[model samples]
Target chain A: MAERVVEARHLSKVYQMGDVEVHALRGLSLDINRGEAMAIMGPSGSGKSTLMNILGCLDRPSAGSYHLDGESVANLDDDQLADIRNRKVGFVFQTFNLLRRTSALENVELPLRYAGVGAGRRQRAIAALEAVGLGERLDHRPNELSGGQQQRVAIARALVNEPAIIMADEPTGNLDSKAGADIMKLLLKLNRQDGKTLIIVTHDSDVAEQTDRIVLIRDGQVEADRKLGRSKKIASKGK
Target chain B: MDFIASLQAAIESITANKLRSALTVLGIVIGVGAVIAMLAIGRGAQDSIAGSIEGIGTNLLFVMRGDSQNQVRNPQPLTMDDAAALSDVFQAPSVINVAPLLQGSATVSARGESTTTTLNGITSEHEAVRGWSVSEGEFINSSHLLGRSAVVLLGTAVADDLFGRHDGLVGETVRINGQPFRVIGILAERGTGGFSNENDTVMVPLTTAQARLLQRSTPRSVDVILVQAVDADAVPQASEQVANILRTRHRTALGADDFTIINQQDFLDTAASITGVLTIFLGGIAAISLLVGGIGIMNIMLVSVIERTREIGLRKALGARKRDILFQFLAESSLLSLIGGILGITLGWLISVGVGAIAAAANADIVPKIGIDSVLLATLFSMAVGLFFGLYPANQAANLQPVEALRYE
Candidate 1:
C-alpha cells in the first residue's frame, strides 16, 4: 500500500530522421513508489534513455499518459513541462553539466534562480551544498574540484529544488570506481534517511544491485522488474 | 527572470568574452563617431558663412545703378542727387543714413614705397554706414569735404604696405595719383567680407576725389550709394522706399528701373539654405555607416547565438522561458551599442577639435559646432540600431529547442 511517486500506463515516442521514422519508445509501462531507490537498466537502443527523458519531463511521449507525483503531465505544454521539471524532477546528467567558470554554490543556486526564489535562495543553496559535504568548496569551480566532488555538487543542485524525484542519468558513467561508490552511497542515503525518491539510469549491474528495485527496459517496454534486498523503511515497518 | 537579473547575466557573458565584445562594438563606435564629426563640421561651415556675412553689416542695402540681369545698354549712373533725395526722411521713412562711394584704382606711394590700391571717395557719414572705424586718427570731416583738402585715411593693408605699420601713420604723407596727401588716420583692419577685401583701400574726401583724383562723366555722378535702415526688421520697407524714389528720379516705369537694391538678408538666406543642404548631405552619409554598424552588430549577434547554442540550451533546461532567452540576447547587444556610443562620442569630439585646430592653423575662421542635440541623437540612434539589429538573432536564440540545442556540438 505504498504511495506511488511515478505511474506510467503506456508510452511511445517516434522521431522522424529525414524520411525514415525511428521508434525510440513503444508501449512503455512502469511504476515507482515514494521513497524508493530504483535503477533502470538496458542495452543500447533499448529506449531506457528515452524513458528517462519522458519521466524527467524533458520530452513528451507521442502517445501515452504519465503521472509524476499524482499530476497527469503527458499532455502538458512545453512551458508547463518545464515548470514540472523545475518543481518536481531534478536532473543529474552523466557529464556533470555544471556551468563552466561558475562557482559550485552558484551552480546549485541556478534552479532556485529559475524558480524565482528571491531572498532565501542563497541560504537554501548553501544548505544543500553543506548536505553534500561541499560547504568548504562553495566557491570552487567545477574545474577546480575532483570528479567525485563535482558529482557531489551536481547532487546538491538536484537536491536544492526538493523535487519529488531526482533522475540521475548514468550518474557514475564518468567517475572512477571509488568516486562512483561514494556517489552511490550518498544517493542511497538521501533515499533512506531523507525519504527522497531516486531513479537512476545505468547499465552497470553492480550499481543496480544496490537499489531497492531494478526495472530493465527492452525495446521501450519494461522487460523485467525485480526487487532485491529489503528496503530500510519496509524492514522498519515490519519490525 | 527579472530584467536586472537578465542584464547581469548578459553582462557576465559579454565580459567573459572581452575581445569579441570589443571587436563587435568597434563598428558601432566608428559609425557614431563619423556621424558626430560630420554634423559638427557641417554646422561649423554654416555658422562661419553667416558670420562673415554679418561681419560686413546687417540692415544695410547696397544700391548700384545697373541692373546686371537686365543687361541694360548704356545704363544711367547712380547720382549724388539721388542719394540726397533718398536721405530725405519724408520720401523714405525707413532710411536712417545715406553715404555715396566714388571709388577708382590709383598708384599710391609713401616714403619711397608705392602700391597700387583703390582710392575710396567717401563723406564722413560713410564710416558709420559701413560700420568702419579708425584705430588711430579721425576720419574725413565736413571741413575736409568743403575745403577739398589733400588729406587721406589709410586702410590697415594700405598702411602696412606703404609704411610697414598700421598705427602712428598720422601726419605722414602719401601720394594718390602722384599728388601728395597727408595721412590723417589708420582705419582698423576689416577682414575680407562677402564681396571684396575692405582692408586694402584708402579713403579720401568726396570733393577732393571729385576735384583731384579722376575724370568724371558728370559732376553729380557717383559710383554707388550705401543705404542704412533703422533696424534689421526695417530692411524690406527701406528697400521698397529706396527703389520707388530711384525709379521716380530716373523717370523709369515699374520693372524697368535701371537699378538693383541688394538686401543683406538675401545673402544670409541664400547661405543658410546652401549650408542646410550641406549639413543634411554630410549627416546622411554618416548615417549610412551607422546602418552598416547596425548590420555588424546583427552579424556578430548571430555568430554569438550559434557559438552559445549549448549555453542557451542549458538555460532553457534550467527553466528559462523563451522571453528570458530573447531578452538576454537583446540586452547583450544593446549594452554593446551603449558602450560604443559613449566611446564614439569621445572619439567624435576629438575629431571635431582636430578639425578646428587644422582650420585655425590654415588661418581659416571655422569652428566645429558640437551641439547636445547631435550627441543625444547619436546616442539614441546607436541604441536603436543595436535593438533593431538584435531582434533576429535574439529571436533565433529564443526559438531553439532545448533538446536540439543541448545536443548541438
Candidate 2:
C-alpha cells in the first residue's frame, strides 16, 4: 500500500581482479518504502558497500532488475544513470566529501548547479545551510569547520536536492562518538520531522539500533530483515 | 554546470597553487616573448636595409672604371664620351640620365676650421642619377663646366665642419687643397642609411675639377658613371645595355669587359635573401622554445590530474558529468597558457622598444617594430598549446570513476 522508493528484484555485482572473478554481490533483492529510516549492516567483505553503491546509482549491477520510483534503471546507460542520480538520489560518504577551500554555501549549491537550477540558487543554498544549523559557517571552508560542522554541511548538500531517498554509507565512521551521536540524531530527526527516506549502511550495531528497520547482508545476500519499534514512532508520510 | 561557474572553479584551483601555476607557465612566457622579439628585430633590420637601398636610388645603376675584383688604372679609362654614348636616346630609351664622376680627397678649410673630406667632380646630371638634391643655392651647371668656375657645393657635414653653423653658408668661400672656391650650394642632411652618407661630401663641376682641381690634361678619364634607369623593372635591361656599350667602346669581346656594372635591383635581391634567411633562423629557434613550452604544459597537467584525483572524484559525486570534469581541467590549463601569452607579448614589446631606443641612441638605422602578426601568432600559439597539451590529462581526469576517485586516499 505504501509508495515504493527502492525496489530491487535481483541484484549481482562481479569485480575482475586480474584473472580472478570476485563476486561482490549475488542475487541480492531488497525494497524500501518512502519516508522510512533503514540500516544495511554487514561485516567487511559482505557486499553492503557494493549494495549501497548500486542503490545510489553511482555503480550499476552486473545483473539485476532495479525499479526506482517505478522506472527501470538496470538497463539505463551511464549518462542516463548520471541524470537519474542527479535528479533523484543524494549520497553521503563516510569522509563528508566537502570540497577543500570551498565555502560551505558553495559546496551545498554544487548539486543545484549541476541540476541547472539557477536564479536564487545562493538563497536556496543559504536556506539549506540554515536548516543544518550551519548558517553561521556559510563562508567557512572545510578546514575552517569542525568534524560535526562538516558533516552537517554535507547533510545540507544531500538534502538541498530533495531527492527520492538519501543514501548514507558509514556517515559517522570518521567522527568521535559525540559527533557521531549528533549526526545520527540529525539523520533521525530528518526522517521523523521531514519524512525523508534514509538508508544508512554500516557495520556497527549500536548505530544501526537508531533506525526503524535493519537489513543484514552476508556474502552479498540478505541474511536478516528485522523491523524495530523505537521510542519515537516511525513517520510514514513523505514530505 | 554552467560555463562561468566551471571557469570560476578552475580559476580557484589555479589560484590555490599560485606558485606551481606560475612556474608551469614560465616556459610559455619565455617562448612567446622570444618569438615576438625575434620577429621584430628581423623585420626591423630588413626594413632598414630596404630603406637604405631605396635611398641610394631604386632606378640607379653604376659603371665602375674597372672590374669588381680589381681597381686598375688603364691607359684608356671611361670618359665623359662613354657617359654620353650611354645616354643617347636612340641607343637606350630606358636610360634617364648619365653622370660622370671624378672623385678625390682633399683638406678643405674656411676661416679657421678645416676638415679632410672627399670631393666629387660630377656633372649637373648627377642630381637626377644619384637622387641627391641641393637644399640651398644651385648645383653646378654647364656654364660652370665650360668656364671652369671656382665654385663648389658643401655637403651637410662639410658645411657644419667648415662654417660651424654660420649663416650665409652658400656665399662662404672654402679653400680646397690651397685654392679658395666659393660655396654655391649645400647638400641636404640625409641620414647615414643602409648605403653611405650622401650628406658628407663636396661636389664640383667635372671639367673644372679635372682641369683646375686635379690639373689633368684634355680628354680626361672619369672613375665611375652613374646611370638612372627609367623605372625599377627596367634596371636589368638598362644594365645590359650599358655593359654592351662599354664592351663595344673598349673593343673587347663578351665577358672580357674593361668595366663592371652594379644595378639597384640586384643589390635589393641579395639583401632580401639575407634578411629572409636570418628571419627564418631566428623564428625557427623561437618555435623550438614553443615546443618545449608545450611539453612543459603537458607535464604539469599530468601532475595536476594526479594531485587533484580526490577533487575529481568529489566533483563526479556532486553530479558532474564527464564533460564537466573535462571542461574544468581544460579551462584551467588553457587559462594558464592565455595568461602566459599576454605576459610574453608585453615583455616582447618592451624588449623590442628597448632595442629600438638603443639603436637610435647609437646612431644606428635599425628600429624594431612589433606588428599585429606577432601578436596574433603569440595568442594563437599559446591557446593552441594549452588545448593540445591539456587534452590527455583532462581526459584522464574525466574518465576517473566516481567511486574509485572518492575512495582515493
Candidate 3:
C-alpha cells in the first residue's frame, strides 16, 4: 500500500554509432514501490544495465515516460537530474569508484559537499563509514584497502546523503563469493531496517535471491516478476 | 569551492608538476630580467653622457663656422675683427662673455719627450666662457696679451706626456712646431669629450698664437666663438641675438647663414629625446622575451590540461562548476608568473647595484639605477601574461564533458 517511488511506462533508449543504430532499451515499463528491495537480472546484452542507467538518472530513456517520486524524470535536464541524484538517489558501483588518492572519510564526504552541506561534514562522513562497519578504516585510501573494504567505502559514500532510494549496479560483480554475500546482506539490511527503496541490477542468482522481489528480464523486456520468501519483515516476525 | 581552497588546490597541482611549472616560469624570469637590465644600462649610459656634457657648463654656447646640414657649402670663417665687433655691437645685458678660438694640432717637445697635442689660442675671456681653470700658475691675462708673449698653457695630459711628473712647468719652455714657447700654466683635467681628450690640449694668447705660433697673414681665422650668457634663463635670447649679429656681420641670408649657434639647453633636450628613444627600443626588445615567456606558459598549461583530464572529470563529477576549474588553472599560471616576476626584478636590481658599485670603484661616470615603476610594470606584465596564456587551457578544461572526461583513460 506504499506509494510507488519509481514509475516507468513504455520507455525506450536508442543509440547511434556512426551509421549503425542500436537499441539499448525497448518499451520498458515497471514500478518500484517504497520500502521494497527489487533485483533486475538478465543475460549479457539484455538491456538490463541500460535500464539501470536510466533508472539511476545516469542516462535518459529515449522514448516514453519515467516518473520518480511522482515527478516526470523523462523531461528533466542534466542539472535537475544531478539534483535528483544528489538528493533522492544514491548509486553504488561494482567497480568501487572511490577516488584513488583520497581517504575513505573524504570520499564519503564528496556527496555532502555536492549537496552544499558545509559544517560537520567530517562527523557525518564518519557516521556513514561507521554505518558500513568502516569506522576504523576511515583514513585509509582505496589503494590501501581490500576490494571488499573499498566497496564498503563506496557504499558509505552512496549512503552519506540519506537519499530516498539506493540504486546499485552489480554491487558485488568483482568480489569473491564470501565478500559478495557480505555486500548483499548489507544492502538487505539497509532496505529492511532503514525502509529505503533498493533497486539492484545483477547477473548472480544468489544476489537476486536475496532481494524481496526478482524481476527477470531478457531481450530488453520484462519476462517475469516473483516474490521471494516472506519479504524479510514477515519472515523475521514469524508471520 | 571557495577561492582559498581553489588556490590551495592550484598550488598543490603545480607542485605536483614541478618541472613543467619551473620551466614555464623560467621563461618569464628571463624576459623580465632582460627588460630591466637593458633599461638600466641604457639609462646609465644616457645619464653619464648628459652629466659629462653638463659638467662643461650649461650657460655656454658654441658658435661654429659651418652649418651641420649643409657641410658642403664653404663659408668665410670668423676673425678677430668679427669677434671684437660682436663684443662691441652685441653688448647686450644678457651677454656675459665672448672668446674667439683659433685651434690647431702640433707635436710638442720638452726634455726630448714629444707628444701630439691640440693647441687653442684665446683671450682671457676664454677661461670664463668654457668654465675651465688653471691648476698651476695663471691663465692668459690682459698683460700677457698686451705683451704678446710667446707663452702657453699645457693640458694635464700633454704636460704629463712631455714633462713626465714635473711639478709646475710654468717657467719652463717647450718647443711647439719647431718654435720655443714658455709654459705659462697647466690646465686641470676635464676628462674625455666624445672622441678626443679635452685635457690633452694647450692654451695661448690669441695674438701670440696667431702672430708667432703659426705666422698666418690675415689674423688667423677663428674656428669657434664661445659665448657665455649672464644667467641660465637668458641662454636662448643670447643665442638668438648672437645668431642675428653673426648673420649680419657675415652678410648671409636665412639658409645661407654661415655660422651654427647651438644653445646648451637645446643640446641637452636633443640628447634627452635620443635617450628616450633608446630606452623604448630596449624596453621593446625585452617585452618580446616576456611575450615568449607568456607563450611558454600557455604551452605548458595546455600540457597540464591533457595530463589532468581525469582529475577534471573527477572534480566535475563531484559538482565542481566550470568557473571553479577556470579559476584553479588561472591561479596556478598566475602564481608561476608572479614568482618569476618577483625573482626577475630582484635579479635585475642586484645587477644594477653591482654594476653601479663597480663603476664607482673604478671612478667611472656610469650610474645605473633601477626604478620602482619598472618593477611594478614587470609584475603587472607577468600577471597579464599569465591570465592571457592560461585562458586557452583553462577553457579547455572547463568545457570538458563530464561523461567523456570520466571515460578518459
Q: How close is candidate 1 to the true structure, as a TM-score?
A: 0.91
Model 1 off-target regions past 4 Å?
A232-239, B65-75, B102-121, B143-150, B175-181, B189-201, B205-224
Q: For model 2, state the Cα shift of residue A78 in Å.
A: 3.6
lDDT of 1 at A37: 91
How much lDDT does each candidate structure score? 0.88, 0.86, 0.82
Predicted model with the maximum DockQ: 2
Error of 3 at B110 (Å): 4.9
Per-residue lDDT value at A72 in model 1:
98
Model 3 ranges with Cα > 4 A deviation: A3-12, A27-118, A121-239, B88-91, B102-123, B134-140, B145-218, B253-255, B350-364
> Model 1 lDDT vs. the true structure?
0.88
Q: Give the alpha carbon lDDT tens digit for every residue of B1-409 in model 2.
A: 8999889988998899999889888989988888899999999999999888878776888888677667444624888899889998778878888988999887899888889888899888987777677888988889998888889988988888877773368878889988989989888678886656667788989887888776545457788899998988888888888887888888776445668898877777999899989989998898889779878988999998988898888777767888988999899889999998998898888889999888888777899878898899989999899999999999999999877887888
lDDT of 2 by residue, A1-239 (tens): 77899999879999999999999999999999888899999998999888988898878899989988778888876567767787778788789988897899999999999888999899989998998888999999999999989999999999888888898989999999999999999998888888789999998889998898999999999999998976234443331
Candidate 2 chain A — worst ten consecutive residues by lDDT sum? A230-239
Q: Write the per-residue lDDT of candidate 3 for residues B1-409, one digit (tens) a residue.
A: 5676567767777776688778888999989988888788778878877877787776988888778787637677778777776676435556788888888887899889999888888899978878788988889998988888888898888888987853568899999888898887888778663335788888888888887775554665777888888889898888888877777788885657778888777777888898889989988998999999999999998988888887776566555667777888999888889988998887777777788788777767677767788888999999999999999999999888655665577
Q: Worst 10-residue stretch by lDDT in candidate 2 chain B? A: B67-76
Model 1 Cα lDDT, one tens digit per residue, B1-409: 6787778877887888899889888888988998899899989888888888888676889999889597776678888789899999998999999999898998899789999888899998887898888998898998998899999998888898988989888999888889999989999887663346678899999888988896588886888898999998999999999999998888786557799888878888999999899889988988998889889889999998998898887777777778888999999999999898998888889999999899878656678999999999999999999999999999999888877777688
Model 2 stretches with alpha carbons more than 4 Å out: A231-239, B64-77, B102-119, B134-138, B143-154, B158-186, B204-223, B230-244, B247-262
Interface RMSD for candidates 1 onward, in order: 1.4, 1.2, 3.1
Give the per-residue lDDT digits (tens) of candidate 3, residues A1-239: 66899999998989898899888788989999888899999998888877887787756889989988888889776656666767777878777777665689878887777677888888999999999999999889899998888989988888888887788889999999889889888988888787778999898888888888999887788888888875856545633
Better of 1 and 2 by DockQ: 2
Residue A108 alpha-carbon offset, candidate 1, angstroms:
2.1
